[model samples]
Target: MELLKTLPAKEVIYSFSTLNPPVLHIRPGDTVAIETYDCFKNQIQSADQEVAAIDWNEINPATGPIFIEGAEYGDLLKVTIDELEIGTQGVMVTGPELGVMGHRLEQMESKIIPIKDGKAIFNERLHLPLNPMIGVIGVAPEGKPVSCGTPGPHGGNMDTKLITKGATLYFPVFTEGALFALGDFHAAMGDGEVSVSGIEVPGRATVTFDVIKGKHSKFPILQNSDGFAMLVSAMTLDEAVKTAVEETIDLLLPYTDMSVSEITMLMSAAGETQISQVVDPLVTVRFFVPQHVLDSLDIQLFS
Candidate 1:
């Protein structure tokens, strides 16, 4: 096992660019206990606070550029999330120009909610069940640097709620050591995150890493207890969904005995797709096909 704690304002990567110096190194099958800050860098404190008051440059700060031993370009780095401990409070904001509902707003609005009894206290009259999730996570991109605010093949700020505990995220290793980093905790968020933000909060995530030899896929894949999902981000929801389904088909082909036409038929008949987020620079769509469906065909996702 290894350990890596974030040094607020330091030991963080705001963008996935060329590899950063490794703050911690570990071999495959090793476990890491890491700390992360909220998307706003844990700076905003109250509902009355203005969105413009926050520093945009320091927005979504991920914990590290962790170097995984033996991870190389074109390989697959498997990150199994073991645990996520969210903070007691969170913040959600909506700016006039910032979300799906932004056009409906006349002024910037923000809310600070308290979490207790497993609920997000939105106000004295309203509260909702807590569904904590990680908002940003990924490895370095192969090309030019990408801001933490954007998401692409390298997986930054996808804002996908499926990235909870007990999920395994497989990312392509474009740079040596993988240079993995993650942050932007959310106490809860809806499917599209239409409001432009989740219940942003600080949290800690414990994960285990493993490198799959020469098993790179076109985009990141997420496997949870329910099923296997292909995560793809694009400029539009339609494009994202298309790419996700296509990649999922590609991944399923080699594992099953079905031909391309048969796979396509099965996906059209049984596959489900959901929105990961619509607020980032790129929208993410997840195409999910149940494990049971694959099991009926004797398909193995990892193989």
Candidate 2:
């Protein structure tokens, strides 16, 4: 096994863009440990701290624009998340006009939850099990700079709960070196993230990088033990869901001989449409295709 180098969170970026320079450079097979600040940039410490007081410009700080050698446009960057270590305390916030339930709230509120023995102490009476995941993970886009708060083809704040340790995320390379970065660690968060935030915490992520030449997916793909999922984001939830299904079919088309109608029928029978988060500037959704279904068809996701 090779040793891992640590990329400090001291230098962070607000957007994934080609204009941003890389803080670290590594080969395709190299594994690095990346440190990150919480979604709030670790500004909200105590419950007394007001969300309005925090600087809007400092939100969702990603650790790096790491340059992966040999990665180029039209290739796929395979990121295998090997481990995650979060801080002892995590924060959550909700406020007026912030998220889905924001319209019903009169003011902003913040909660400081303690992590103890693998659980988030929501309160004295309620303790939720920790399911640490990365809220923002992405690469530089081909054109304009994308904020860390949005999710798109370049993969920003998807806020998917499944992007945890042991999962592999694939991003389409749009520029030289891939220029990847990630942040916004969540101690635990449910689907929809209707509250505008999760148990946000500062953490470190250990990930291994690999480049797959001559192939790429239109959208980011999250792969776990069970199967592969197509992550798509759009201005509306309905649009995101529809795009996810369409992209999934497009990915399957090249590997199988099934017609579009046949694949659509199979998806209706075995696929799952799930939400990643609804609070971001764009809503994210994922369409999952089970591993068994692909296996039965003799299909390989990246082959």
Candidate 3:
């Protein structure tokens, strides 16, 4: 196992496109323990901090473009999240131009929430359990740089709450060594990220990386105790849903004898459509097929 420490300027990459040299290099099957910054770069530490004073460009800093030995384009990179530990407090902010209800808001707002004994203390009367998650994670794209704030074929800012501890994420390898990076820790968030932000905070994450030669995933795929989910992002919710369903069908085809119609039927009955976030430049949707459903069909995501 190797340790990759957080250095706000160097190791923390702001965009997936402007690929820099890897801060650290590790081979497949190696474990790496890394630290990540909050979406605000820890600039707003107190609730009373001015939300309008933030620099948007400096938000969502990711931990690395860590190079993995032997990981090449057209291959798949499997990352198993061993742990995601967050800080005692997190900041959630929103502006008139953000979120589903952004158009109705009058001005910018911010909140500093403290986590105590596993719950986010929203106020004196309301608290919710902590569900720490990774909000931004991806490999460097093949062409022009994509901001850490958007999501696409090359995953970035796909604020899916399911990306928690004990989940395995599979990303398509577009560039050599994958050039992977991650950040934007959320102490807790709901589907759709309806408010345009979650309990954003800085944290440490431990993960293991491995190479899956030859096979590639067009979008990110997640595997957890409950089932398998394909993370798809697009320009609109309808398009994102369509892409996620299509890709999931393609993935399920090789393992089942079910015809297209039969597969669609099965999916309609056993699969679920989940909204990741609708706030980014691209919308994200997740298509999930339960573990029991796959088990019944004797299907496996990777052989």
Candidate 4:
């Protein structure tokens, strides 16, 4: 295993682009411990800090564009999140013109939540269990540079709460070495990220990387104990949901004897169309299919 620590002065990127040089190189099957800054780059340390004081340029700083030896174009870069270690304090921010309810009357506010014994102390009356997840994670895109705040086929800030420990995320390798990087740790977040922020915190993610030659998904695929989910992002929630359903059907078609209509019906019956986060530049959605459903059909997603 190799460790890539992110010191305060360490270089972090706001976008996922081939233009960015790789900070570290490793072969397939290697476990890397990547340290990361919070979504706000740890600038909002106290509740008294105003959200407007933050440098908008450093909204989401991903740790590294780590180069994987065997990853290449058209291949799949498989990343298994082995573990996540977050800091003691997490921050949440909100204000007018910020999130889903931003238009409502509200001034800028920042909250510093303390983490203790695996729970986030939301307030004096409520303690929520921590569900630490990686908010920004991706490889370089095939096209132009993409902001770290957006989620797309190349994965960026998907903000899916499911991307926690024990989950395996597969990203399409667009460039050689699959220049991958990640940051924006959320100690706890809900679906849709309705407030534009989670319990944002600095953390370290331990992950194992492997290259799956040739085969890759149209979008990223997240696999966890429950099942497999197709991660898709688009300009709008409707578009994202439509694309996710279409891609999910495409993925299942080849593995089953069922016709498109039958598969569509099956999906409607059992699959779940869930939201990741709507606050990003591009909204992300996931179409999930349970393991039991696949098992019943004798279908295996990947060889």
Candidate 2: which stretches are off by over 4 Å? none
Please give the ranking of all candidate structures by lDDT, highest first, separated by commas.
Answer: 2, 4, 3, 1
Expressed as tens digits, the lDDT of each residue in 200-252 for candidate 2 is: 99999999999999998889999998999999999998999999999999989
Off by over 4 Å in 4: 1-9
TM-score of each predicted structure versus truth: 0.95, 0.98, 0.96, 0.96
Model 2 local distance difference test score: 0.94
Find the candidate with the highest TM-score and give its number: 2
- Which residue pairs in model 3 clash with each other? none
Best candidate per lDDT, number?
A: 2
Off by over 4 Å in 1: 1-10
Which lDDT tens digits does candidate 3 get at residues 195-226?
A: 89999988888889999997878999999999
The C-alpha lDDT values of all candidates are 0.87, 0.94, 0.89, 0.91
Q: Is candidate 2 or candidate 3 better by lDDT?
A: 2
lDDT, model 1: 0.87
Better of 2 and 3 by TM-score: 2
The local distance difference test score of model 3 is: 0.89
